[model samples]
Target: MTTPSGDPTDHEHWRRPADLEPGQPAPRPAAPAAPETPGYQGPPPTTPATTGWRPPTVVNPMAPRQLPSQDQDSIDADERGARTLTYGIAMVGGAVLVIVICLLCSRVLF
Candidate 1:
């Protein structure tokens, strides 16, 4: 049998399995001699289809980023100020309660 087209070695038109050596360049994929179509019987079309079949690529859409609201900074500042005022008031109340307790204890002992 004649060797297939594009094959480098024409020796005996065929190579035994053991005859091939290692590190041989990969053989190119042979173009299909016939194109498959459903229910069509005729001489394969004269014009080759310009484009080949391609699988649809999956595109990862980027998520939209969220920016801070216009009032965020002002709201944070107001909350911090309110916390500071509440802490100051609590400290003053605790000091007054301690002084009152000390006076009552002294009076009871005397």
Candidate 2:
């Protein structure tokens, strides 16, 4: 690469070793000047507020209850009667199924 001629007038053409020619005087390096201090004094201002969108709030209406309160004795008797009827129906059905299975098994074996 070619060295720069270091001419003040030919500033545009200068590239580098950045070194001066042998007989030329070395130029003193200039101290960099500081940037000017900013004059901003306060916090930045905010934009005006505006309401955009809102969802509606709602309550569910309750259904009317029409059941009447009854005596404790009557309620207990009703529950017992229901359970007894269920057990009786289950026993009768199971007995009929067992009898039918036994009859089928005997006929097949014979």
Candidate 3:
């Protein structure tokens, strides 16, 4: 682990078995030169009309804006009768607590 001229088996700092020979590849660097005003050419003739977020030519009041058909069937029949009266009062309070725990275990074993 020492090779700044201090030899630890330095082939210029190691990894030498004659420099690889089973696949090939190692050479890629050349892609940077595209700046001639590459986009947006729609509105800037001294900014006179629509600038600063112009997405509403007619209707875009922060769009998700859609509820105008009879108040969506009266709020979908009031959220489907409030989820069917909360699952019919939790199945009639689980069948009246299983018939009051089977009449309190048949009067505590008669």
- What's each prediction's TM-score? 0.37, 0.39, 0.25
* Model 2 lowest lDDT segment of ten: 11-20
Question: Which pairs clash (backbone N, Cα, C closer than 3 Å) in model 2?
Answer: none
Q: Report the error of model 3 at residue 79, Å.
A: 1.8
Report the C-alpha lDDT of model 3 over 5-26, residue by residue, as the tens digit. 6655756643434555656554
TM-score attained by model 3: 0.25
Give the C-alpha lDDT of model 2: 0.83
Instruction: Give lDDT for model 3.
Output: 0.78
Best model number under TM-score: 2
How many collisions per candidate? 0, 0, 0
Q: Write the per-residue lDDT of candidate 1 for residues 1-110, one digit (tens) a residue.
A: 55567757656454545645676765667987896668858787697555875767799788999986689899899999999999999999999999999999999999
Error of 1 at 68 (Å): 13
Instruction: Highest lDDT: give the candidate number.
Output: 2
TM-score of 1: 0.37
Q: Candidate 1 — which pairs collide?
A: none
